[model samples]
Target: MWSGDELDLDAYLARIGYDIERDGELAPDLRTLTALHRAHASAIPFENLDVALGRPIPLDLKSLQAKLVERRRGGYCYEQNSLLAAALERIGFHVAGRGARNRSRGAALPPVTHALLVVTVEGEQWLADVGFGWQGPLEPVPLRDGVRVEQDGWTFGIGVEDDGIHVLRSLRATGWMDVYAFSPQTYQPGDFTVLNHYSSSHPQSRFLGQVVAQRPGMDVRRSLLRETLSLVRADGSVEERIVTADELAATLEAEFGIELDAEERAGLERVHAAGV
Candidate 1:
């Protein structure tokens, strides 16, 4: 029920690094999905800037959508995915949120969970994620299994787990790596807030102690993490480097479109010092 005036849509597109025409034109199916994927890669950077900087990250829809689209900023999964959901809904797509689970930093999974989104396009269901840094998906993948799929030059596959849930993984040089698991359950916005609170405010949550980000292009992916900045090209060559504190700040602004104030900078310095 949020309305994006002309200014709002323009601002939102700017935040995500998109330049879409605002007239009443609807994107064709492939173009719609592609735009969604690219919009996610460019506009909503995978980041926990608020938590690391000791600020209260709002979980409300309007606030999040405004920050990401209207103000031209980046956010973590909850923020990014949520804003993407809103935009998709605005553009005539049916969407739903779902619960998920992830380990904190290098830790093991919580006995409980996290949150994600399941989108319905045409007659196919796809996984739409705007969060999860570095390893995040570039295009919405079919929520089915037993077949290999490819996008943005990377191959992915889904299969049934021992527990009967759907599992996804990526094919890498070494081998396949597990990305996440999901079920066919339907979910809502309220479900997401619960998971977001646990992930954002819990002391053991790695978002408070570490930094992570990712961006996508036609055939490459760029990721900025706690101690590494890497670019994975279309042909699978990965160029990486360790960044200094100054470089980290620069990357946030230059790549993610986040504008951190002086106080936020001091807070980020403390997070770097803590080093998880």
Candidate 2:
């Protein structure tokens, strides 16, 4: 029996631009691994438009799968991580869903603001992430603590801490900075819900006040519409332009693959008018 609230496997895969065999058997091997990488890279784009639109980001498998994979939506950490967990399990991969804290500042780390997958293949475990916006990993790497793995123009590694928490980071010009941390504890949907609500509702939350959206490809495309709209490329180059309501809608669709309704368009106009 399937978990009542679990996300659909086939639909989720299709949402990410992948077609699976309706009746053919899926084997656990490198072929499966490669397919997953391709789907993650191509199908679901990392984005934050829902938060800016004042819509509650859903963490349940079905809703998240619908938003990201069905309606062709984009989401933050919780939504993307949750759906990926469901898809990996449905395909017979041994997986673990782990919560992570963003401790880049060397503090006690924040709440469960991020998520990643741990899978055991051939007696080895690897960390897999496809939801992080611009700074996410492109492929799964060995889960060896404190070992560096080269990725797309970056180096990433995980560090095992004394408090039983694992720290993840990317190698920068200065040094290694903490990204997030996690443990072996399993995550329930409600955990993510609390964090999502806080991020969307809190007055201090950045998403509630700004228009931030990003799409990843050969380069990272980030657009921030506050005071003035700034479109930035991967190499730190930027293009500044003034946008009307129609132009904003067109930019959302053209840049982030997000289609807004009338209400959403009106809300976006309000944001633009407020100069935030």
Candidate 3:
């Protein structure tokens, strides 16, 4: 169970720009779930600057609220999904955690390093993830196998393999490409803590020595990996350019909506320069 009672519900709703008066009453229904999921995904970015900065990534509700909600910053899967799980639970929805393997990198069998959520509404389960970076879902995708949903212009589908592992795929120009896959096993916060350690600190972790930030939108998706900034449009067009250390701070704020403080900016700049 996520620690929902300890979260600042008002601040979180406000941070995501979800006004109860305008959006709708807070209820544990599909409408409310989709609205909140979309709002959160569009509002918060996905970044691993803390990992690159050599800072500890805490999973507690208070720390999550302080660093993500209050600070208006972004985080990777664990932090983003954990914060969302708390908010949804606080709103009276049934939420559970799941571990997933990264499949974007072709032919590589990585460990289960991704943390996502499965929310039940009216006895139906939905895959709600706000932390998959640029390839994440804007709204919850139903858990039904072979179900496909379109959000704005992007399309996502869910399929079950012979081993009973559910895979989430996206429709690229080439075809349906695997995004990530997870089993039916339910993971706990402590489980994510273990996974987070490897992701944030392990030398082989992709986030350890690089600056990564991503924002997924209806028209375009932006990704800042180290010094290269890439933009992919809905029509399958791609544009990329290198970002210098001098432009790192501005690029983060402008492209990914992540505004780092003085110390973080300096540290990230150094990491970017070294990585380049």
Candidate 4:
């Protein structure tokens, strides 16, 4: 199942700032699921810095723990969700993987490059994903079609198409916007490895040459793509500005909570100076 036994559950709990003594014991229940999901989403950011630095993205549990939990760094989909899946599984939840197409980009059909999790609690399924940068749900969304849930001020819903694909949508100012869609077919860890290879290394992959980091919050969402940093509020207002190489590291740390070492900071600055 997601190599749950190998994960250091206590370390992960601490990383996400979840306190068992204060909150409660970890159990395979909805309350525990939602608490962990929200905490993980808020604590770990979503970033593709390693890919931008031309580093290999490893999906092993040990590597994920070392890079994300121990290093206090962020990662893109596979790394984020894989770590989450492991933690949830270790807590006795039934977690399964699913591959999704990126519909947020536009009408053009993108390949299935995103990885998410479906966890079953007391025979009910929940769509649990902490990887989808700014547009992701803060907590697990019910897998039922037409079910809508609001977290703080943001609203998200699930819809089923004629083909039986479940589409996750967010209620934007314009209207309901599709975030991403996935089928009923469950994916495996090996399947995510294949997708991760393409996303981390393929020349056409958007993560390859640019710096991308995102943090989602209740009232505001921040996104840094290459040199541009954009902040979008729940009311549809957006403020965007270009970030120079000199400000990249500080911006990441200040806005996304991503701390980079001297080498990473120097390398990313070079890339930012060159532009995407």
Model 1 lowest lDDT segment of ten: 1-10
Please give the ranking of all candidate structures by lDDT, highest first, separated by commas. 3, 4, 1, 2
Q: Give the per-residue lDDT digits (tens) of candidate 1, residues 158-233.
A: 7777666766677877667677777667667777777778778888776767776677655667777787878887
| Deviating ranges (above 4 Å) for candidate 1 | 1-7, 17-24, 27-30, 103-107, 111-113, 162-164, 234-237
Please provide, for model 4 over 49-84, each residue's C-alpha lDDT reduced to its tens digit, 9 standing for 90 to 100.
Answer: 999899999999999999999999999999999999
* Alpha-carbon TM-score of each model against the true structure: 0.84, 0.79, 0.99, 0.98
Question: What lDDT tens digits, residue by residue, belong to model 2 across residues 1-276?
Answer: 113236566666666666666523455554565467546755566666678777777776667766777787777766776677666767777766677776765676356767667767777887777766656666676778778877545577988888677777877666777877788686665666676788778876656756665544444444444534455444446677766655777777876777878888888778766753
lDDT of 2 at 98: 72
Query: 45 in model 1: Cα distance from truth in Å?
Result: 1.1
> Residue-pair clashes per candidate, as listed?
5, 1, 0, 0
Overall lDDT per candidate, in order of appearance = 0.68, 0.67, 0.94, 0.93
The alpha-carbon lDDT assigned to residue 74 of candidate 3 equals 91
* Best model per lDDT: 3
Q: What is residue 64's positional error in candidate 3, in angstroms?
A: 0.6
| Over 4 Å off, model 4 | none
* Candidate 2 overall lDDT versus native: 0.67
Clashing pairs in 4: none
Cα shift from native, residue 121, model 4 (Å): 1.0
